[model samples]
Target chain A: MMTAIDQSEHHAALENARREFRDQLIDADLLVPSGIAGLYGRGAVFEDIIDGIDRVVQRAGSAAHGSGIRRLRFPPVFPRDSFEKTDYIASFPNLTGAISTFEGDNKKHRALLGDRDAGLGWDHHLTPAGTMLVSAACHPSYSGLTGTLAQDGTTMDIYGYCFRHEPAIDPARMQAFRMHEFVRVGTPEQAQQHRDSWVPRGLQVLEDLGLSAAPVAANDPFFGRVGKMLAANQLEESLKTELVVRLYDDLDEGTAVVSCNCHRDHFGVTFDIKTEDGEPAHSACVGFGMERIALAMLRTHGLDVARWPARVVAVLEG
Target chain B: MMTAIDQSEHHAALENARREFRDQLIDADLLVPSGIAGLYGRGAVFEDIIDGIDRVVQRAGSAAHGSGIRRLRFPPVFPRDSFEKTDYIASFPNLTGAISTFEGDNKKHRALLGDRDAGLGWDHHLTPAGTMLVSAACHPSYSGLTGTLAQDGTTMDIYGYCFRHEPAIDPARMQAFRMHEFVRVGTPEQAQQHRDSWVPRGLQVLEDLGLSAAPVAANDPFFGRVGKMLAANQLEESLKTELVVRLYDDLDEGTAVVSCNCHRDHFGVTFDIKTEDGEPAHSACVGFGMERIALAMLRTHGLDVARWPARVVAVLEG
Candidate 1:
């Protein structure tokens, strides 16, 4: 158990790290704060880095020995019913954003307008729109496969804007972010093997891009006191592995840019996804937080793209 | 003025046009609906077309003769204060979504979870988070230039995921979409000239992609009865021009896939942006609705990208 002083020291250290990234990003003009914590406008240089990282990751996937992957793209929001079916709110209720709207008649709208003009809030007039911002890229992918899977299983590459309502001063933890994920659904053994192999493959991809990365055991960020126990169970089961890299020269403090997870049958049970053999299909996914990885690259290398390592430049520019 | 019957007829015709596109997209498996109108998960083919459109659009900008353009990227949400400052609520109150969260404590969260478990609504716990989904890509771009401009002025290429709350079954009008925009801040004449040139350039880009496009006078979708007058005034002043393309075989019913607008110091005044000469900087922007353009391409050329025109395919695949 951590003491109060230890906890405070840890908090300060984390703050210092966040400040270092925020200050560098601001100085390089790579980020423009919107006066909102954990949300900022990224500049061209930052976007270019993201684009480069995307290319490298995609290339890595294509080079892998597998059946061609089906690529799917989704908007930031998902159906509220689908979200509920996933039982996500039960685990992480505080981390989701529901998309709501003002569904009032003209008179009520006039009232809303009045509120806006009177410097009062207009949100009171807003009603739930039966949808919510996506909490993960794979949510829709799994929801899309609600029924039986193929006998040989399936592989999909999915990307989308994901949202989590964890607002903080830390640039690494964005409220709204992009996620690039590769998901596979098959027998339990096949799924586990895929995730185990991806742990190293993810690291290799980062290394090929001139980033120093190491895979470490990790767990999902569950919420509440009960969630602490769940996290502990997850770590004990070795359900998640992350590829970590130092954002700065201090190797002791590393950030997880890529994560690989094996969900033994969690999604299959929830979404009624079954293999052709009539059993619940196991699933696994490797997700790369694009913005965090790009930020890590910027933090590791200098802000100048030209000054980046030649191999890294070649991989990105290629 | 349109009669009540004429207005109803117009609405029906628009709905039919939308249905035509949605049906075609569904048949092609390019889209998977998320149980909501105007919201869908895009498949690989759809994503590829979007990618192709982005490349064509970017190339068009780079090939343009001008001073180098600064590129900026912003996330979907913006500071509520900045949004309020823009006074968007005065005109389009019905068409925006705010990013809010559940700020309740752990006990409150437990109660929320109980409500979720009971199948009662849980959204009641959410409160406004002081930020809103961006209504336009240029909102942040203009907000970023809130101070003074250089003598020679500035040109920026901004892109972002934009949102509107107008839910419809029409695939042509998405609730959440991407907008690729070019914004210029300078003297009145300079801004106007830039917008005027982009009108033709936008059409040319579409033509090169084997799409049939025409420029026409247009107006923003202002709300309420008062909004009609505002829209008429806007069109009368020739403030907006759009590149229209037929979403289906019916050429009479065309959609605006790209738009060019001259704000004439509207943003400058609102954001307190001034030129080096001590005058409010006039601003103009040309925005391309990426999904709409890609959909237009698929509609015009057919769903099979491999069979597209050689020139168009080369430009996209290159």
Candidate 2:
């Protein structure tokens, strides 16, 4: 078993490596610093690579589903009540994004200004807008699809500007990230089939992009004692799988670039959605962390896109 | 010399027209409502049109600036200090969006659950993240480009999912909408020239897309008495212009689909960006409200994409 000192040392080393990679990216103008941790701007080169990765994934999704897949776009902030139904705040309250806006009159505004001048925070004046920033690409999709579905169900290509409150220096762990999710909502068999098929297909997508990747049984970092039980059950049932890549050679396991999950009928029951057979629809989604996958490509191939493999370049640059 | 009753009637009529247009969009399934005012999810058709409009704007930007323009992408949020430098809150306090997240540990989480269970909001448990949701496309671009520039100046294509606190039923005014900005930063001459040229060029771009638009003198709705002075000064200097379109035929004036502003030395000095001459840069940008323009298109044409004129359709469909 690892001792306390040994664990601290390991964490230090891991952080150093992450910092080193971040410095390299900043030096090459691949990333722009925003002064805040986990919040960095994407330079032209970095955005280009992300664009390439997006195209690659879009092509893959289209190839598999054809016109069956439809793109769903949502603004980052969603209705607060919709978020409440998901109970995401219960497990990940620390990472939830709630919008606070100035809702006061002129008198309150003057007091806010006074607080600002006095060097005190005026955050209290900014009341909650009754909306929460989207934490996942598929979260907002459910509220829009609340009624009934067709016989075979629906396939959606949902993209969201996701937010998480974990501020860190790791380039892979951005506070605000983009998640591209291929979600299937329908019968239990269909949901399972979608997740099962994506496990290999997702690994292949990254492999084809010239990254060494593998599928690993995984569970989300659920919070608290009850969360521990949920995670264990989730792992035992193989409800979650992650396609991970070795971002750093020194690391034992890989970082998850893609997460494939079968949520059973949790969302369907909560959102009041039913399948063609009149039962609660089972939902499954394969979410691609667009930036993380691109970061892996940068680490494996090189930061320079022109120097990447010709085959990979063609797929991304298209 | 309209009576108070007349004014109220005008507002009622305008709201009725907005509701009518919204109903049409809903029936067509082009716009997906999130059950909240101003927040929406774009259906496949709506997304396709947005894609088309983006391509059209991109083509216009590229055709004018060539490789001289670079695309800058920022997350939906930025540092609170960075926002303060712009002094935006002083003028538009009610429209600012600040992020709040749960910062408490397990003990606090338990208390939070208690409050939530008691039907009282746990907003008090959440603290400010020191990052505000982006309100403009070009807001975050300044902090990243805080340094000397080339002799000729720099041009950038920036896009942002912007937010404003004002929630409304008018389809043209989305609380969370996109702004596609073609920005130029340099000498005073360069900034003015950029804005002046775009006054006509921007109109043409929209007109080509078959939007019945025209440029009119405009001013931001600044807060209170001081804001009135700012607005007057801005108007006197001709610092702001808007490309407005008639959302409803009964309205006296059109709604702004695009805003062209010359923030001369305002952002440059604020962000500490310098031009080739060692003096502070002057900034100008033509911001196209993507959804508003698309809405204008839908109003001008029809809700059905297939029924739109071929010339107009080609501009957006590409």
Per-residue lDDT over A214-306 for candidate 2, one digit per residue giving the tens place of the 0 to 100 score: 899999887777678989999999999999999978654778999999999999998999997789999999999998998999999998888
Worst 10 residues of 1 chain A by lDDT: A246-255
Q: What is the C-alpha lDDT of each candidate?
A: 0.84, 0.89
Best by DockQ: 2
Compose the digit string of candidate 1's lDDT tens values, residues B133-165. 788898977777878888878898888888888
Query: By TM-score, how accurate is candidate 2?
Result: 0.97
Candidate 1, B-chain TM:
0.92
Compute fnat per model. Answer: 0.66, 0.82
lDDT of 1 by residue, A1-318 (tens): 989998888778878878877978877888888777888888878888888889988887777634468888888877787888767776787787877776666688789888887878888788887777888888877777878987878888888788888888778889888889888898998789889988888998888778889888998888788889989999999999999888745524688899999999999898889999899989999999998998888877778877998988888876
Q: Provide candidate 1's TM-score on chain A.
A: 0.94
TM-score, every prediction:
0.94, 0.97
Residue B110 in candidate 2 has what lDDT? 88
Clashing pairs in 1: none
